[model samples]
Target: MKLSKKQARLRRATKFRAKHAEKGVERLCVYKSSQHIYVQLISACGTKTLASASSIKEKNGGNVVAAKKIGTEIAKAAKAVKVTKVAFDRSGFKYHGRVKALAEAARDGGLDF
Candidate 1:
């Protein structure tokens, strides 16, 4: 049977996460929705979120601009807590459009991934 779109995304996410688990480093995870983009810096142990940022407070959440802002915010937050490097986990989303914008902005903001 063919998997639905959401199911397919989840399958990809599971596979990505499995590989991420082996790295044993902090992870920068990004999740995007129709109305918002969320990002989190998770501890290596997967027990804590070192930092998080979202477009929920912004007037526009569904745009590349908003994604970039969230990425900059997340990078600042991570640095304030002394987090410099992390694994980028796109949560099964394609690395284009908003996701790409966010990642580039984060890099510009000084987070290495």
Candidate 2:
């Protein structure tokens, strides 16, 4: 079966989610919109959001610079919650541009991907 680009990505994402579920580890899911980035640490039990960051105005900054800002925020927030290791979930988006920048910033901020 042929899948459109977006559908293919979603299909790919489903696999990652399944593995993450089985591993039972906190997950760092990244969502990148054309103008914004969002990240969340979902609990292993799948019952709560451990931490999150985004391009929300209160956080400001939405470009590559802004993505970096959110990355830092997510790292700090995760640390505050005592989370050090997490699986990086790219949601099947290609790892470049904003996504890459955010991951790098998160690494710089002390989150092990």
Candidate 3:
């Protein structure tokens, strides 16, 4: 079977999601598109969103700088909700470039993952 790029990425994502689901820990999920990046802190049970951040208003939301900003924003939002730990779900995106910047910024902002 030949899988498209998005389908392959989604297949990879399912493996991580399954593990996180079983553990029932809060998850910080990230998704990026050509025009924007979005993040969400999902509850342990996965039924609710605890916090969210994005780069919709940034001048160039697809860049690393914007991703880093969104990361810190999400961390601050988590702190306000009193959550310090979470599982990072990169949604099958390679952990480099913008995604890497976001994760590092989140760590710097005091999120433990």
RMSD for all candidates, in order, please.
0.9, 1.7, 0.7
Worst 10 residues of 2 by lDDT: 56-65
Q: Write the per-residue lDDT of candidate 1 for residues 1-113, one digit (tens) a residue.
A: 99998999999988877888888889999999999999999998788999999999999998999999999999999999999989999988999999999999999999998
User: What lDDT score goes with residue 19 in model 2?
Assistant: 86
List candidate 3 segments past 4 Å from native.
none
Indicate the worst ten consecutive residues by lDDT in candidate 3: 16-25
List per-prediction Cα lDDT, in the order shown.
Answer: 0.93, 0.88, 0.95
For the record, the alpha-carbon RMSD of candidate 3 to the native fold, in angstroms, is: 0.7
Task: Estimate, for each residue in 9-72, the C-alpha lDDT of model 3 and write its tens digit.
Answer: 9999999999999997899999999889999999999999999999999999999999999999
Error of 3 at 18 (Å): 0.8
Q: What is the Cα root-mean-square deviation between model 1 and the actual structure?
A: 0.9
What is the overall TM-score of model 2 with all chains considered together?
0.92
Number of clashing pairs per prediction, in order: 0, 1, 0
Better of 1 and 2 by TM-score: 1
Evaluated against the true structure, the overall lDDT of model 1 is: 0.93
lDDT of 3 at 29: 97
What TM-score would you give candidate 3 relative to the actual structure? 0.97
Candidate 3 global lDDT: 0.95
